[model samples]
Target chain A: MRSDAVLNEAVRGPSGPRKHRMLPSWVATTALLLPTYAWLTLAVLLPLLTMFVFSFMSATPMGKAPITFTLKHYRAFIDQPYLLNIGWTSLVIGFWTTLLCAIFGFLAAVALARATVGRMRETLLILILLPFWTNGLVRVFSWTMVLRENGFLDNVLHMVSADTGSISFLYTRYAIVLGLVHGYLPYMILTCYIALVTIDDAIIEAAASLGARWWTILFRILIPMAAPGLISGAVLTFVPVIGSFMEPRILGGKVGVTMGTVIEDQFTQAFNWPLGAALSFTLLAVVLAIFATFSGVLRRGAAA
Target chain B: MNNITRRNTLQLMSAGLIAGAGYSMFPRKAAAAGTITVLNWQGYGTDEAWSIKAFQESTGIEVVHDYYSSEAEMLTKLRTNPGAYDLVVLNAARCAQAMAEDLIAPIDYSKVPNISSVAENLRANENFNKDGKGYAVPWVWGLTALAMREGLPKADSYAVLGDPAYKNRVALQDDAVGVIAAAALLTGQDMNNPKDLDLVKETLKGFKPNVKLLWSTEDQWNKSFAAKEFDVAMYWSGGSVRSKRVSKLPVDFVVPKEGGIGWVDGLGIPASAPNAEGAHAFANWMIDPKFYVEWATKAGAPASSNVAAMEALPADDLSRQIHKPEYIATMSIMSALPDDRREAFNNLWQEVKAFYAE
Candidate 1:
């Protein structure tokens, strides 16, 4: 009878008499979460709130300019039609980069999952992640050595065919795509690898036994199983590629003016913080819209 | 303005820190004195180890430095951190803005004796002198001009940048103001406030066939040149000097017949300076002939504004040869541009770049 009473007390928390004496569960939870919430408020939310305010200002609140609120900055796209073209260019670049990463990354992850195992898989995983160790600027700069005229690619080509003309494509969109792919490919691989590793080996074996061809098993089974990873990787790659300036600036050369560079110019060169903030908010809005459109798929993927 | 690239600035900051730590081991009499902080571009003359060491030993005033990568950043630092900086380096084009904001104090010329030797025209330039009060001491000046490979024929005009013969072999600096100014010069208009911006845009767009690279940094320009990326580029006079003297790149700098876009940097005392006396002493030393010669010979530098400092250079210095005093008369010195005009220039340049991409 005494043990039963103890079990009852454990299930119902403290006995009724002592209930008021103990701290509330919500209070304890709030205490636990307070640090993280406080940190987020200070670091992320506060700056974002400040930028949001600045975006509506007539100009940067510097010097002796009398500050006034305005929506002219948000009307930038309507005022300057060229921004639409630049926005489209950024999207196109993002699309290509994401598609390329998905294809290459999915294949690499499949190879790691099926073709390799044990120590070999571990070593390959490390090798795949080695690029992250080097600086992004260094990686972008190294591409010039490989892609420029009379560079490594040209030198190797000349060795193969003495009369071969220069095939250097540095300062081109292709070069920008290549550098970006090199920089962000690891993200796609790691995410896909996580999704692919959890699939049962029996599923593939059963498909094979049921007269499924290699392509059939691959497309019908493997891809569906890896959809979550593919979506996640595409999101990761596309978001950053659209906002990237360094790759375009270094590799695309004269063709490098994107929304990213324009926004950068407003803050650093033009000293127009309001315009930059407005552009940034517009970009953020587009990003949010994308997430909203894909929310259903993302939710299903997360649940799976 | 001598704006170092962000990458170079970080490297310079670390290098400065290491040097600063090394200097502390051999503390001089100034070690115990009050510290006076200077605001400037990292690796600029103010933070040079040898000069800082010498200045400290002689004056018995500890000098520390803070750095900014861009003129905008420099202004932000001055505005946000009152009394944190005793001295700051301001571009002549920006001196008016700083003065209007009261970020800088009126420089007492009597305290800076070296001002007497500075070029009369630069000293009296309305950019630094506003309402008959000097705000900045003219420190160094340079111009943006054509830098061509050694074997190429000398380019006497900015039109060479668009010449069809040099198709896909021309590089342009990636600064909106500098590029627009060059185009304005080509179109026979005032560079600072061009009345015919559309004409200037057309002129810039015409160079699309020739522009292979739009280089932003000295390092990038050098590497691209070394890689045989382009034959000619719109490069800085100081950059050309360093390319030839330090990196040993085979390049020739020319002002062209239309003249280059000129810019002057000045040293100014901030309005909230705690060590105004120390700042004056440092400014005097900065423009001193002895210091200029050492800095020029050992380290590549922009042309000094001080006439005596320029004359004190060895007969064959690259900077002296490139930055001729007569060029100052022909060149259009950049002045304080209104915020709207600056934005317009940036937008025009962006539109022109998009056109080039097409």
Candidate 2:
């Protein structure tokens, strides 16, 4: 708080020769922020407020039907017992996806930071980010080609063995996890890379000089420094994965009823907007709680 | 000061040309009486570029189109924007709902002479006719049924989908209404409003061992089939046609002894249609034998409701071969569902899907 106050004073400039001709700093800041606030109010806040109102309604305000305010939609988890299972399934999927991404991504980031430098490091970083250039739906669909029965993987397996049955694991929860990890791994890598790259090489050399083995150095030194990045990456990944419908719907086949798909069904298939809004708010609350839990780590990561 | 140089002259000329081009590209405002707006699914019959051009050439009225992705969206568009749409395409199941909401007006069958050629069953379908007043003109119709791999024994019933012999080799549609309707038919109950939903649920649950995929889109179904995902699946008649004829997948559509789940789409004018006369004229043209033939042969469309239009197709046409008139009698046409029943179906389907995941 003291540092923040000092920074604010520094930004406002040394108050010693206040120019009467110039507008106040607060006015300038407000003027600069007004357009952004207006845009947010128009685009995000208004729609969210509308949906909040809708969530409390008994029915969608359509045709000539009179709408009444009701809280039945919020009782969805209790009223519909099956939703609890679906919500749990979504969390499980999110947990696995986030775990896999952190494992593979952190290792990749460490490799990029320590093993490569100059042009090679630049090239590796670009390669890591290449997935973001393509459409996410296209990437998920392509995984089907690689993972389906008698697909690229099975064919390769058949090439090695004369008589091998198909070993495809497509249309399963594993496939859903694989698709999500592939989609989110780049985010984990980028975050960890940013955090890891900032570490002074002298610190690592000093640990080596102290006769610490590679694993010890990694565990005691690098991991501690990179904890913020890992937390931020996990939060980023878990939040979206829980809400993702496309990866599960495409890869999971019959077993893809997540909270995302359930909410989508209310809006698109069932036309139960009130229920959809209620579910969305419930999901938002869950997401906000997650953010609150990780707020400290996220702030520290930003500071780093 | 008029100091006109060669560069300035050239710039002015190019600017004038660009302005002229932009002006020409902008759609001219036609007299309200001469223009009619239609609301339907994108790339459906109404918005076909060739057909719309032909329609404009034949009739003085111009055709513009707005699209809705879902039935609820169509109703919402109608409710919110009065006089915005002259005509809308509604499934027979949704016609009653639209009429109940007073979103659509009663059709004057006399104005649509070609509607006479529409198949008697479709023309007299109770979903479009209420209180002896026709709300919509039956346009095109199809069924949701089984599509099986070629060389497999022809499926004679929906029971074949639950056969454990094809374990992990059967696909089901990922829709509540269609899936429940199929299950209802399997359990010997009314597809629209089944009395024994428990039996229907049990029947669907029994298929879990054989259920490999619950496909939502035709493209996904085709890709999965091509990758040898499933041999037998619940698929659309129109999709089966496109699969065999266009995609060249080895699949045959079979309407079982119990019957396929039938759906009919009709053209209805909005209650507040600004140009009701033009809407009627366009509606008549849509059902016309000539227009139906062109659309079916060239663009690939659902079977026409007009018997004469069906007859106009060549003897060997796949659409004609598959969409048999006799099937209409055995089929169970979908009807408008009450909100509670609709919610129940959605909940049941979600539960069954969750069970599948388990």
Cα lDDT computed for each candidate against the true fold: 0.86, 0.86
lDDT of 2 at A28: 99
Computed on C-alphas against the true complex, the DockQ of each candidate is: 0.45, 0.39
TM-score for all models, in order of appearance: 0.83, 0.83
Best by DockQ: 1
Residues B246-265, model 1: lDDT tens digits:
68999999889898898888
Residue pairs with backbone overlap in model 1 = none
**Would candidate 1 be rated incorrect, acceptable, medium or high by CAPRI criteria?**
acceptable
Model 2 per-residue lDDT tens digits across residues B140-220: 888889999998999899999998778999999888999999999988899989998888888898999999999877778
The clash numbers for all candidates, in the given order, read 0, 0
List where candidate 1 sits over 4 angstroms from the true fold: A1-43, A62-64, A294-304, B1-90, B97-117, B130-137, B267-288
Model 2 share of native interface contacts: 0.78
